[model samples]
Target chain A: MSRPAPRVVEFFSGPDDLSDQQREILRKMGERFPELTVDELPLDSDKARERGIPLAPGLVIDGVILGVGSVVSAGRIRRYLQPQQE
Target chain B: MTEAPKRIYLDHAATTPALPEVVDAMLPFLREEFANPSSIHAAGRAARQAVNLARSQVAGALGCPPEQIVFTSGGTESNVLALLGAAFAREESGGKGHIVTSAIEHPAVLGACRFLESRGHRVTHVRPNAQVCIEADAIIEAFAADTFLVSLMLVNNEVGTIQPVAEVARAARERGILTHCDGVQAVGKMPVNVESLGVDLLSFTGHKFGGPKGTGALFVREGTELRPIAAGGKQERGLRGGTENVAGIAGFGKACELAARDLEGNIDKVTRLRHRLIKLLDTASPGRLNGDPEQTVPHVANVCLVYVDALLLMLNLSQRGICISVGSACASGKLEPSYVLRAAGMSDFASFTSVRFSIGPSNTEDEVDEVVEQAAEMSALLRKVRTPEEIGQCDENCPCLWEERVA
Candidate 1:
């Protein structure tokens, strides 16, 4: 069976408050992972709160918390998304 | 796969890293030269000489006599002292009750004006042009028989727009209104001669250039009567009362000296790098440059990318190892959009989508190129997710819903 395309959702305090650095990182991740679908998770959404995501800007991959920090690079996010060998 | 390096730092306008020379100049004061400048002993005399020398250097840098320079804790304090001192002096002299300032001024001036307004002083905030430059005529028009002070910034911190301070000063002088300039961003970056500008008061901070933080100065032209804000020991000629920040002042003086020597060369270098970065971004992205390109400072560039979410873009850039800021660093921590941009007629979406890239001497052409490439890529990615409807609703067209979405 083919591997499913990685689904990633990035949560932010607000849509307009992204720093230039953060925006650049998201762009790189998009290029490196062509099959990955990136979505913006609203901070006030019940779904984001249920997942125990921190109040800071963060990213989640395939329903798993990936990273919680300002300006998370694509390489670091990919590490979290990579499938581990059994 | 190896991790990508952290994003490059391009936000020098917010605050610059202290230069190695400034650090070296401050080490002795921080460690061994721990004497009170006012003490009568040899150690005290030595400290006093250092302070005096630093003062003279700063004065020289500003093309004013050393006696005119009054050291303050930072730009905020300097701004307060300049505005309040002049306003109070005018009031004491039975002058007018009105104060005039530009809408594009740093919060330091605006806050001071607000405080004055609370105390029954009327303040008229002059709006800037679409290019973010404040007109001298607007300031003149705002002035009245009761107008005693006009506060304007030499260079706007957000958009890097240079104000017509000389003309404004000349106009204010004609009407006997004291003019104060917040030169925090302009000093050390450009040639600032108080005599030429003809302003009675000016404020500058060290960290904005390369000196230590918490150190700044205000130039009160000789014979300009002013009231003291801080009451204590007669430090800073009794205007500001506190133990002098000897080390920081020494470092600031050194920074000013170096800035004077390197101002032209640094401007040329940073301007070239900024142009190169802007050119690259223009070629690869649907980004519009904010502010007047011709009249802006060399080291700052404000760019607004359409369709891309500012927050997402910032996160992605951080992930890519490039460090840039959205709007002013002072306003970064706040969830609200930039007031400066809004005042300049930028829509909520443009203000939200805009990011400021302030370059410094430490930045390189290579870093600028890397940033531009990453920014272009990130903008493209964010744009992919934003539909045309979303883009249309980004600015003022859908303010009510947009606030709901953000809130």
Candidate 2:
């Protein structure tokens, strides 16, 4: 059986404020992990508030708050998305 | 007590609070001494005396003759007057002259040059080298036989890099080119002698040095003919024809006097505080100091955090009651990267991540300590949310990855 896809969520204070470098990071992450699903979460949204994300640039992976206030690299996303060994 | 919610300001480069002495000196001008300096009455004489005294005070601070100073609305007007006035004079003398200026100059100077260009004048914008200083050679290389004026800044407003104005001035002088310096950031924050700089014209504003806004001065050396930009009453020796900003000029004079008197001590204190803040920031987070650390002014510190957007960081700091800046106040409200940093050879991303912290004489050690603690805590907290590898191989765009990039 194939493993389930990793979930990736990028948080931003606003939609228009996304930087080109940040968009590049997300695109590269998608290329690395084919099963990875990326989502942009705006800080002003109710969903972001409910998740208790910091009011800055943030990234969450599979329900875990991985980063805030910076754009994450593809290599780091791969490391975070790797399957745990039992 | 909850410590009064800590309202520390690190944006002295934007504008300083008027000093008590400045305010006291200006009060008489605003109240009983209020009169048009041009009027022939006793009140006018008193006002003229105040303006003359202020002129002398400013001249004493700048090490120029009082007669050479022309009071104007502010730095912007002073810069425009110097650039436009000289360019027009050159044009009248049978030359549609070229002007050479730096990319890192304030908008006022740049705008004046742009306006000149729109009027059939040519302009050469010299870019800074990797070291962030506009090398004297660059200015010399940009100068053509037709170049009539060279306008460079004393201290850069964004990165705080000090240019070799004296060397550039000397080079321009040898070539018979007029020289103008926007000394807004350098006048009170550092040692500024118009004579020693050997420039034909220098401009400085009041608010940057704890004086009122709307007051500024331009130093026009003797024998440097300039056409007046504004046609009005023969005020400011017919160079800048307008009713003087009496209170603002009085305050500006007092501010200059105080700044000249205590400049060395103030520089020392602000330097120590600036270094302390930088050190604390380095320990708190992984980042790089922008600009030539040694060559830049002691009061302004620019730092580029690896993956952090400077605007976001500034907002975070503001939330904590700390005042900081991503760039110059003039460039505020725009998402574009700093043109000054770009001109200084900084990458676009690096420029986007940079923040400037400017110190002032009024800033205390305790405030510095608070700023450090807050800045460090915020930086560390922001970094912790992401993995160390998340920043990944920072290119030239990443100041965090390069040590030698700081010119």
Candidate 3:
């Protein structure tokens, strides 16, 4: 059977809305992982809080917080997934 | 990944990009000319000469003698040294010391005043009027019988209002009170002559005017005795100690020379840009200008946009490669609303949302237009989604709620 699509959750703080740059970063990551399943998580969400995410505009994959702030590079996101893939 | 966009920096009040000429002047000192300025060797003499020349350049820029200028790390150190040194110098002469200053002073001066108060010195902070300006008579009125020093800033860093330092300094001089002016924002941006300002001590830094960081100086009038802040060899005429920042000093001197070259022309150019920005921002957003337009320096324009969250706006602007500063600063790891605005009688909401846009000589009109356009468009979008607290319905905008949210 085919491997299940990797799940990527992008978090924003304060409000439910995502900024243009945040959406663009998410889009870039989706391009690399064609079958990527994206989820929006507000920083105040129980999942984000329980994981001890330091800040918003964060990326959570495989139940681990990877990064925060204005991240745009898909290559960096791919590298971030390396440990999780291993 | 695509290359980053060209950044449009509009925060000269915080710091300016060091000029290419200044960088060239500093590099030799940083590399081959590195030497302890105090050593008796030939190399030391060369460094000492460079430091002397730098002092003269700074002195020339301020229309003072080179001997009066004492180099320090930056504006903060210069301010603290001036305030504490003046306070202690008076106490050493068997007189209890007191200082009269304004409420909107930078934290450096405020911190120094608090330190003096802890050491048994008195400090009276005079509140500014609705125009965000301290009246000369008001400052003089606050002076106590034992008041030995009056410290005031030449310009309010956040609001850009030029203070009546010369008039107050003159009045204080007549009363035998020494005056120190925080000229960090005024010295290079405009004409700042110590004689004209009538200040016994004036603090200024290089980074505010196209020079390297970690370099600043304080002007102590001739025969004004100041107790040393540090214990070391007889550097800075025993007022400040330790080895001089040779490279930074060199860059600072070059910047001063260049800044003074065509002061009036530079002022006119920046003034035109400030007007253009104000007009554009006024049309695009419903907000009030925070400073006295007539009395302020033309570089910094602080505006308070109604219903828009400034931190959110700043994040959006940063994504577009436009750099601006907020009127409020991050204090103790959490950003706080402007105490400066509160002291100037602004409402809590206005203070929380005001943004400071400081223009430099290098900034072009097109750049100003682009930045303001982006700012206004983003702010409008942010206002729609902002919480009730951000729009002044609650106590204050909890900055941590969106502090880490960039873009």
Report the number of the highest-DockQ candidate.
1
- Per-residue CA lDDT of model 3 for B93-212, tens digit only, reads 957778999999999999999999999988899988766888999999998888899999999998999999999988898899999999999988988999988889999999998889
Best-matching candidate per TM-score: 1
Docking class of 2: incorrect
lDDT of 2 by residue, B303-396 (tens): 8876665655675676567888986222322356688877766766677668999999889888988887877666654454444333333455
Error of 2 at A26 (Å): 18
Best-to-worst ranking by TM-score: 1, 3, 2
Better of 1 and 3 by TM-score: 1
lDDT of 1 by residue, B1-407 (tens): 87768558888888989999999999999888999998999999989999999999899999999999999989999999998887777777785499999888888899999989988899999988778888888888888888888899999998899999999999999888888999999998889999999999999999988999999999999888899987777988999988899999999999999999999999899989999988988788776778888888999998877666565566567656777777623233344667888787777677767888899988888899889888887677556544545444544532223233333
Query: Chain A TM-score, candidate 1?
Result: 0.65
| Per-candidate DockQ vs. reference | 0.08, 0.07, 0.06
Off by over 4 Å in 3: A1-86, B332-334, B387-390, B393-407
For model 1, the DockQ equals 0.08
Q: Which candidate do you rate higher for DockQ, 2 or 3?
A: 2
lDDT of 3 by residue, A31-81 (tens): 767656677767678866645443456565544333444332455456555
Error of 3 at B136 (Å): 1.2
By summed lDDT, the worst window of 10 consecutive residues in model 1 chain A runs over A77-86
